[model samples]
Target: MHLDNNTNSEGQKREYCSNGASRGGAKIIKTFSSRNTTQNLGNNRFNNTSNIGAYENNPLIKSGRVSLDKTYNSRTNSKFNNMIPTTYETRDISIVFEEDRQNAKHYDMLEETDDDIIVTGTNCDTPICFKTWEDMELDPRLMENIKKSGYIKPRRIQAFSFPLITAGYDIKGQAETGSGKTAAFLLPIIDKMLKLKFVSMRRTPYALVITPTRELALQIHEQAKKFCLNTPYECAKLYGQLEKSSLNRELDGGCDILIGTPGKLKDFTKNLQINFSKLAFVVIDEADRLLEFNFANDVNEIINSPLCTPISKRQNLLFFATITKELERYSMDWMRKEVATIKNKRENEVNNKIHHNIINVQGLSKNKLVVDLLIDEQKQAEESDLSLRKTLVFVERKKVCNILALMLMNYGIKSASLNGDRLQKDREKAINEFRSGQITVLVATDVAARGIDIFDLDHVIVVDLPKDDFMTYVHRVGRTGRLKKGTATTFYNPETDYDFKDNLIEMLQNLGQDVPDFLQQ
Candidate 1:
């Protein structure tokens, strides 16, 4: 090694050193023009292909050249990189695709997802959350389904709620729709079932899940099937629409897990001869709706029925989208006294995944405005070279849904109607057509489409706001952002919808959307 000292014209002392493998040998060495040879990196713009002082300051390798993203190491480093170059140059590059833009935007929301986890109740221990579901050492079959379902990481709620339930502690969690609470409870339940196999054949179901609606039950059933397909576990869906003979046959055949609504299941208690001695786990999803919809007596009947085991031997899980005095009181009785309460901390009151807004439509312009929206969407799709996307319009009445569907068709927009009045086959066909993009618009009552996961749905319009239940509004808007980015627009009539304004305003603000004063309370 050799050292050299020099003084620049500014009278600043600089020290330089040279080193090689051998005493007299010379090798590749880096040079920097700085007051100190160590290169203070103090406000000095780097223009050459030399290593930066910090490990995170490495050149962003893009297009076979260095990209001077001020804070760069790799493309996955962070979205906060300063794109404005300081001294290093950039080369010709192609336009970034929408996928890349979405990735960048998703990375940018890391700060927004830094919500706290507030857990309460007795000796319930919080779960150690793994970065990915695979890290939890789940069964290979379950892990495969999770990956196929596009699960990259367990959501915050899933990470926190898993342990409490797995430990046999009753849980009451408050999580909003689309927050992945389904899998949070389902996964732990499935895991427990896989390990609880008996030495001999068991007659009664080992678990029971009661949901507010048949659609939600069916949704959970589908997910259950996906995870339990390759295993020996059997899950059955019980509802009133099924034939008595078929229901009896399924019950006779045997079921390890049962999912259904309280009313239907309560009817089955007398209508079908079944065993419930082995029942161990009970989940009451959407507990608030279960109580409000007058299913409380039926649910209590099922839980306290002599056929089932006592509360001491059973594990209970209750979930609600929001916290309220009534829900809390109801949960205390059903959920064990020392049950764990897991409440998701929200960065905002509204789901960040969906964009929410209201379209003020005059008396006669409602139909015309809807038609215009379809036309503009088509035009924008053609301009962007994207495929025509699907849209859903929610109506308050089954009759209105049919009329709106007809109006849209008369306007030359491919559309269909779906409501509780439609036959099962007809409703299924309508849903299939809309999902396949055969028809670009679907007009339906909220109850008809609950728990329907349309992967690529692009828009949702609420034509008739529910008079009281804000959950109707939440479920309507939540339909669009199911598996991807989506937008929601409500046809607001200030006079009729004045009761909905406060909730609407709160929802918009939680989604980080700008709101008007009239809508604000």
Candidate 2:
């Protein structure tokens, strides 16, 4: 990396360096000594902040410091520097990047890589290596598909999980939502299918992907389909929302990659003659949620049913937003004997994309507080053209979903409600509308917190915190900050949930968020 020595107005020698390779050039404008850094997608450095420029509106640069010379890209000739600007009104995208991941002080305090705590029991025949997707020598078609989907680089989980799964090892991956876990599993599975030239016939499945919610199943289906294009494979989605006849028709059609909920799969196996006898690979997405009482029995029954291939024969991949050591132990009882556990570091696992926060409040003012916050967000969106896409307000009780939806509308905020109690069609419609940007706010329960993937969601506010541990809190706020960095602000009312206080403080501390002493007790 090259360093730029320049003097600020105060005549202090300030050192600014880009993380990218240093390009030797023009004589030093000025010399400074101090450590301050800036990084970006394109290898662009800006140390000449003296002259005034026209494109001063770039939010990443200080308004006064922005100048025509600094804003122009020397290579691409793009107007807004070399980096592609996101459609949303955003500030420095790399500002929150954790330098600790390097040998720097950041990772020393709270590292983003779980290399320290990893447990590898799988006796793989081949050594796991490579740090990026390019190094892996994946299938040409799959690589082309990945680039078409605009993924320039693989995230940490994807980098680590892909090699293991491709080598045919059972793995449990723990990463926050939006960290690209879907591709981490799907890419390897698809590549293996292509390599083996495997094909599934009607009434039989080669691959089974079970998720906690239909929404997540559909999300995975959409991405998996993109990867299956132009290949000798097809993608089918099975959820409770389909009618009996329609579901039967899909089951009759060939399913190279079958994505569905556990309960629906069990129903099909019991009544629709759906077969999984030849299942080669099984992905239990959101494994922790599958263990919840609402789904645990059905999930257990499906995996152990005679229709499913034996655990010893088929490869297994379990993924969750959060999985503790105790929970991992619980999952281990069912996983294969030599399952590989893949976990991103705790600091990185808490959804770093979202700005996490907790605001203490009395129970009664909770509604008003949420309304005021939404109003403020709306006003800011209008002023900055950030385009508030969707705000999800999560509560513990199902009834509160409806109550908050109506109350938000009464307060002049357009809103929707999503919960398990709603009809399957209604549930699908709610998800579709919210995703299409037709709806601004959605009030939901914990049921929608896990497994549901909503892109471009602007914010997630927990009106009432869950009594569960830190994992639930992470999933609740993880609804946003995807598509772009969003906010996860929660309201903490001690009177309503005194038990949540300690976990809240501990989570904030671990996630690198501030914890006020008032909430620490």
Candidate 3:
């Protein structure tokens, strides 16, 4: 019999046969008193220290039953049969070793790699990236809710952000839209809220989320409700056009988490006797959009409200699809100077699964082109035995959005329009119809570009590209390709869009898409 060296669960070095042998049998054959320079298993054996580790750590081998060769069983070798327990079966040993090798390799990778996410800030103290929800040590009820929500594991952003936020450090995080940034901040904050006892005397909220748009505020509130299920926490949303009485009713009924837009939140602080002493968390979502000239003053006033918690006292979190130096500079005025920034290293890298195409509409009409594209998409879906394609057509102005919806309807295409000018109820109806597949196409302005999560979106058609901001173009196309493969087609007019051509060409090249000849000129 040929012998090979291996260690058991205990630190005892012993030699065993390559064919098969139990730990007790190995102990009897060769108990090493000192280190050996080399060892042999059989004529077919090879020397490799890696295999030794695999064999020593393999569960099957450690359980006192190493697989035996079928040839050994054929030979009525009484001595060999006696050494190996009959409980062990004759099976292919390579499969067992491969599994052990793969497991060890994966463990090593997990230990050695942190390149997937990039984090940086002033005096940044790095935070742990949890691989599982259990690693976060979340409340049992919260964990149950998370599982019920079908979140098996936290996304990369969530993995890194959870620990930082849970540790009560102000963080500025940037990730691509629809990358689960909401849940990253929400889960950790909810976990913390569950730990603190609710004070009966407290009148203000425990946490406040300020978003750029009303639709986004509603979406966040909806998601928060799911996580807060079966818990004592209550969520309320405030935005423009929400009846004052209803807003008061939500507040009077006791809201633990209040989510709202700047204008309405600013009004609430001025009109209502809301207390901010109990507020422990503050989150600014879509920080780039909220910092725009139109919303910036209101955002500043709301944050600086006398009743609001001092910047030093509360944990602050700012999330953005695209983080900029200007936005970061503005944030530092209100946020902690030492705020740690967690960013997805791959944020600028567009998904290769999304196909991007740009057409110069110098002479052709964009309206007819969009209609043709939608019709073609419908035909393709039917040919492929797939569901009807759901698409979002983006325009630059509310007028164009309304006009395009009407034009589509005139062309016998069932469509809806979502823009800021639309009534709140009307906007919600359009979103619901489009989301439910009752309407295949929804035309909107930049208002739908951020913080809106729609599943299974098949395509995005940018009928009117943003005037100057390339990131706005990114956000527009971001409407689709969320959880599935999608396509984005932009209608560019060189006459008016010449100034923005270079930006578009650069973005297309970065995404590995071909830039058109016209744009090259």
Q: Which stretches of candidate 1 lie over 4 Å from their true place?
A: 1-116, 124-127, 198-203, 252-254, 382-385, 448-450, 516-521
C-alpha lDDT values of all predictions: 0.62, 0.63, 0.67
- Candidate 2: tens digits of C-alpha lDDT, residues 1-521: 23444443334432322222111222222222222212211113222231122124334344332111212333354543221111211112121121111212222222243233343666654436556668878889988776565565666677777778877789888776766688888998889888888866877777889888887787778778778767878778899867878877876666888999887888877874777788888888888777664676787687778767888888988887666564576566557887887765553356655655556554234554566566655665677666554788887765546545544554345566777766555566666666655567888878688767675576788877766566688778877754455667677666777887777666666656566544656
Best by lDDT: 3
Q: Select the stronger candidate by lDDT from 2 and 3.
A: 3
Candidate 3 residue spans exceeding 4 A from truth = 1-115, 122-126, 200-203, 346-353, 383-386
Enumerate residue pairs that collide in model 1: none
Error of 2 at 196 (Å): 1.4
TM-score for each prediction? 0.73, 0.72, 0.75
Better of 1 and 3 by TM-score: 3
Give model 1's TM-score versus the native structure.
0.73
Q: Residues 1-521, candidate 3: write the lDDT tens digits.
A: 33445453335433222222212234223222232212221112323342344345545446643331111212243222111111212222233233223333223323222226777763556657898888999999888877665565677788988888877789998887656788888898888878875653344888889999988987788778778878888887888876778878877766688899988888778875567667788888998888763677787787777778888888888988777787867788768766878886776545444566666556444565566556555555567686556789998876556545644543345677777766676676677666556667889988898878775676788888787888888888887765544677677787888887888777767766656566777
Model 2 deviation from native, Cα RMSD in Å = 16.2
